[model samples]
Target: MRNTPLIEAFKENEQDLIRFLIVRLKSAFAAQDLAQELYLRVCGLDESFAVRNGRAYLFRMASNLAIDHLRREARQAELRDELQTFFGDEAEVATPEEALISRNELERLERAMAELPPLSRRIFYLSRFEQKSQREIAALVGLSPTAVFKHLRRVIDYLAAVRDT
Candidate 1:
């Protein structure tokens, strides 16, 4: 099979393109993935589209992808900060017995979480921490809503059992 024009351009400029991406993305691995995505995007272009400078076109695509990555990372950081502000603080004053009970309860919850299956734990976090609906978690995790509900139910039951004992 013959190489497409896009592939040929990519082969010629792969190293320089990756170096440019790394400068913007700040991670070699992420730059490599972005470079591969750029290649796929360029491959989708019609052959009739005229490109006077293939290297310049590739650089522009890489730059745009890097910008998108930065914006997504910034949004995630902002969300994390907001979540901390909302849930980080509680009433500071407590009796010694109350504090001891809180600590023990926290330890039990941690152990309960640790005992969960990997997918079950992820589903719990997506539901509680991210506050996603069951339908949303199903779509994100590629499970049926029923399955998500079951996993969540399992988590609740486990935690309740931990609390009782």
Candidate 2:
């Protein structure tokens, strides 16, 4: 009934609440974050607010917060599906022949990459997959910036030739 005592109890039981939330939510990070949010929500309650059992009330609040998180995630997944459907061609499912062609193209690209010198292959991966800038690639590979540019250009040209064939 007393606000100060209730707030103290909430703080004292913080770990227990987080453990409960983790079990319900199945994510330690989310449980910790939501537990902090639950504390803030409880603290924001009116001082005159009364509950018969403060711990039970806190548990109920935590449960509601976890449920809300799950609901939000579900809604977001639904929205993603709807957007993909609306976008049509960009998200369209590929036909069997198209899939085969795409797979073959990827295999050809992989073979072309394997044909490059080891350093050139590493630089290409760092630039394309890891998305490092040319300057960063040069620093990592201990190459001059111009040399890195040349290596990348060579790789591109080689891939273009492979695609043409």
Q: Model 1, stretches more than 4 Å misplaced?
A: 89-165
Please provide, for model 2 over 77-162, each residue's C-alpha lDDT reduced to its tens digit, 9 standing for 90 to 100: 88788997897658778899999999999999999989899999998888776556798899999999899999999998999999
List the pairs of residues colliding in candidate 1. Answer: none
Per TM-score, the best of the predicted structures is 1
**What is the clash count for each candidate, in the order shown?**
0, 0
Model 1 vs. true fold: TM: 0.52
lDDT of 2: 0.87
> Candidate 1's C-alpha lDDT?
0.87
Worst 10 residues of 1 by lDDT: 86-95
Error of 2 at 158 (Å): 59
